[model samples]
Target: MKSPTQIINRELKAKKKCQGNPTKKYFKELIDYYINIKTLNEFCFAFLKIKITAKIAIFYFF
Candidate 1:
């Protein structure tokens, strides 16, 4: 979790650079950051596949 002060400072910088409220832009950047982190995406995808596989197995067995 980001510290409040750190989050505030980043929002201030982003807002100044964008010359408006930064929430939307910040989220875009956040998504881009996550995409760039392939390991995290891979972990999430693997977990999701596991969950779906488990559900399918249960559906067929019961």
Candidate 2:
């Protein structure tokens, strides 16, 4: 088993190694991806609603 100090030092080193622009760019990309997915979902939902409404209209009319 590792000592507590060894674990702490390792964690600190990892934090220092990762601190900078890479993290920011990753988050920005993540947010952009989320936004794109949300837009696509909304578009699909709208399309489905229109399609269902059309089907209902045709059923009643025919």
Candidate 3:
């Protein structure tokens, strides 16, 4: 199996090949976005939980 760094490098290379001008900053942005999503997933789950609970409460009252 490839190491995490190796996998990341491979992905960056692929992105560069597809885009034709990949920079180190581009890879950095990609990593940042990936991490941001992980953090955002928790927020999304909480939001969904509240939304579902609110819907259930509305149905119960109506």
- Badly placed stretches (over 4 Å) of model 1 are 1-38
Candidate 3: tens digits of C-alpha lDDT, residues 1-62: 33457545855665675464444444454444344444565446535644564576468656
> In what order do the candidates fall by TM-score, top score first?
1, 2, 3
Best candidate, TM-score-wise? 1
Please give, for residues 3-59, the per-residue lDDT of candidate 2 as tens digits: 446534743554465557434443344334334443565546535644564576468
Residue 27 displacement (Å), model 1: 35
Report each candidate's C-alpha RMSD, comma-separated, in the order given. 12.9, 20.8, 16.0
* Predicted structure 2: lDDT: 0.48
Shift of residue 60 alpha carbon in model 2, Å: 0.8
Cα-based TM-score, every candidate: 0.37, 0.36, 0.35
Best-fitting candidate, measured by lDDT?
3
Judge candidate 2 at residue 36 and give its lDDT: 49
Q: lDDT for model 3, on a 0 to 1 scale?
A: 0.52
Ranking by lDDT: 3, 1, 2
Model 1 residue 37 CA deviation (Å) reads: 12
> What's the true lDDT of residue 14 in model 2?
45
